[model samples]
Structure formats: C-alpha cells, structure tokens
Target: MNPTAAILIIGDEILSGRTRDSNMHFLAQELARVGIDLCEARIVPDRMQAIVRAVRELSAAHDHLFTSGGIGPTHDDITADAVAEALGRPLSVREDARAILQAHYDRSGIPLNEARLRMARIPEGAELIENPVSAAPGFSVGNVHVMAGVPRIFEAMVASLLPRLTGGTPLLSQSLRILRGEGEIAGPLAALAADYPDLSFGSYPFQQDGAYGAHVVIRGADGARVGEAMTRLAALFPEDRAG
Candidate 1:
C-alpha cells in the first residue's frame, strides 16, 4: 500500500467555516507528488482537549499526520501545548528553537516579549521544521507534524518538509469531462472500476453554459491500469471524445 498520510486542520476558524481550508488541498497534492497517499483529514477547534484527541487519533491512523493552524504567538494558539498533552510529553522551549527565535528578535529589533516567546516552546524531542518565510519554526514529534496556520507561510513550510519524507509508489490520475450528465456515464464508469479494482474511478457533475455535464477522474498507482481505465471510459462516450 502507498504510504498513507492524513491532515489535521487545528482551528476554530476553519470548523466555523470562517476560513476556507486550502492547506489540506495543498498538502494532498504535494504529498501525492511525493508518493504519499493522503487518506483522511480532520478539522478541530482551538480547544486543547479537542486538539489532543484529533492529534492522537489521526497520528495512530496514518503513517504521517500533518497539523496546520494554532501554532502562533497569540493566546488562542495552543496546538503545541495540546499536542504535547496528546503524546503525554512536556512542552518546553528548545535551545535550537530558541536560537532561531532569538535571532529573529535580534534582526527585527523586536523585544522577545512573552507573546513572541510562546513560539519558541515545542514538544520535547521534536525536530524543527524550518520556516523560511517566517522565523517561527514548525516541529515534528513522532508521526505528528505541527506548522503555522497562515496560508503563504504554511505552504512554504510544507514544501520544505515533504522532501524529507519517504514515499511509496506515486498514484497516477487521468481525467475527462464530457458535455453529458454523470447519470449518462455512471453505469460504464462503475463497470470500469469493478474491472480494475486497483484503480479508483469517480464521476463529478458540473453545470456549464446552461448545460449539465460530468467530469470523470480515474486514479491508480499503476499507470497502465489508469490508462486502460481511461480508454474504457472514453469508449463509453465516443462522440464526446476530442482529438
């Protein structure tokens, strides 16, 4: 099986739907490129107990657990502390992380205030994930990885961390969208999926120009199987096939 992974989005803002989640989609695409299958994702509020539960559950379920949000300088940012509780470890300031934070303070001429110092505290024994965009570093404790919540910064951190992970055979996907409704092709796509159990077939309906249609996406770890499934899918809608 491909190296399975999951994303844990830790924030009340996300669950409240005030913030649309882009990190999961970003991490999903990036991990897939590195051959890690993103199996599941969970979003939790900024509560300590909730965050702890999510971390423990998702970490146990997947080979890797990526958590975004709540690792900031504010009081509401408590992902690091909650993660420590989940792992039954102490949350302490690390010398390595302190050095980075201190240097950031020095360079910016900003005082190392208590609010800013909160960023230095990490779960014991966790390795730091560099934040090139910002000085605040992320950390990896066991299978659980914690990073910042801000979008641009979070994306940068994920790009840096993904390369260090070992991945499985990358899944390949191919897609086709026809000007026909999903109902028109559901039976054929289902047959293709059944014939190639290793391949994942999906049909998505869309509305365009006052017409309804479907987009068919086929996925499989094996390129040959994915191609065969696509060919069979296309054969079902001959007139819709483009040159």
Candidate 2:
C-alpha cells in the first residue's frame, strides 16, 4: 500500500492571517508525485499543548507526518520541544547540530549566541534533515519530519528528503473539459465513480466567457485504469474536450 502522510503547520502568524500558508499545497503535490497519500493537513497556533496534541494525533494516524514553521531560533519557535514532549523524549542540544550551526555562523561572521544555539536542540533519536538553502537544519523525530516555513527552504528540504522515502506507484490523472454544468453531469459521474471503485472522479465547475462548464478529472495509481475511466467519461459526454 502507498504510504499515508499528514501535514502539521505550526504558527500563530498563519492562524491570525498575518501570513498565508504556501507550504501545505507544495508538500501535498510533492508527496502525491512520490505516491504518498496526503491524508490530512492541520494548522495550529504556536502553543506547546496544541502542537503536542496535533503531533501525537497525526503521528499515530499516518505513516509519515510533515510539519512546517516553529523550528526557528525565535521565542515562539517551540516545535522541537513540543515534539519531544509529545513523544515523551527529552529535548537537548546535540553537539553535531551545534557544530554545523557554529561553523556556518562563524563563516558568515555572525555570533552563535544562546538564541542561535537553540536551533540545535533536537529531540532524542531524531535525525537531522539537511538544509541546503540555510545552514539551520530540520530534523525527523520518529515519523514526524520538522521543516522550515519559508517557501524556498521548505521546497529545498523536500527535494532532499523525498528521494530517501519509499514510494508506491505514482498517481496518474486526466481531465476532460465539458461545456455542461456540473449538475447535468453529477449523476453520470457518480455512476462512473461507482463503476471504477479504485479510481477517483472529481467534477470542478468553471466559468469562462460568461459560460458555465465543468472539468471532470480521473485519477488513479493504475495508468490504464485512469485512461479507461477517462475514456468512459468522454464517451458519456461526447462533446467534451479531453485534455
């Protein structure tokens, strides 16, 4: 079976609308490309209890958990500690991580003070995730992979991490644009979905040039099944444009 994953976004800025989240969608798409199902996503404030609760719940329910935000050197960055607490592990500064940060800061002529050192505090038994964009690294504790919230850094970390994960068959998809309303196609789409229980069918309504239409998309792990479903859908709506 394909690995199941969940995302936990930790930040008060996201919750208060001060910052818009762009990491979840990126992670979801990347995970899907590697055949891991992104089953759930959640955002929580920078509270220890809330982060701990979310981490514990998602960690237990999914094969992998990817988290963004709250791993920085700032005061509100408590993801590492919360994860440690949730897993019943002690949070401490590892010399190896501290050395990496120290060398990076020394080369850049920045001070590696107490606040900067806080970035090296990892949970027991967690593995450090390489950060190419910045020297500060993310870590994977158990199944929870903690990452940065910055879009560029998150993307970079994912590029480094995904190749190491085990993936099943990649999902295949096809879309057909029909010049008909979703209401007109809903019944037939439902029937088609029931016929191919392994594939997923979705109808997305769109408006173009003051005309309403729908895009019927078929997605499945089996390319042949997806193509067959797409063909059946197109035959059902003969006038539609298949793309």
- RMSD in Å for all candidates: 1.3, 1.1
Per-residue lDDT of candidate 2, residues 128-155 (tens digit): 9999888789998889999999999999
List residue ranges in candidate 2 displaced over 4 A.
Answer: none
Model 2: lDDT equals: 0.91
Work out the TM-score per prediction: 0.96, 0.97
Which residue segments of model 1 deviate by more than 4 Å?
A: none
lDDT tens readout by residue for model 1, 38-117: 98988889999899888899999889999999998999999999999999889988888888989988998998888988
- Among the numbered candidates, top TM-score falls to 2
Q: List the residue pairs that clash in candidate 1.
A: none
Clashes of each: 0, 0
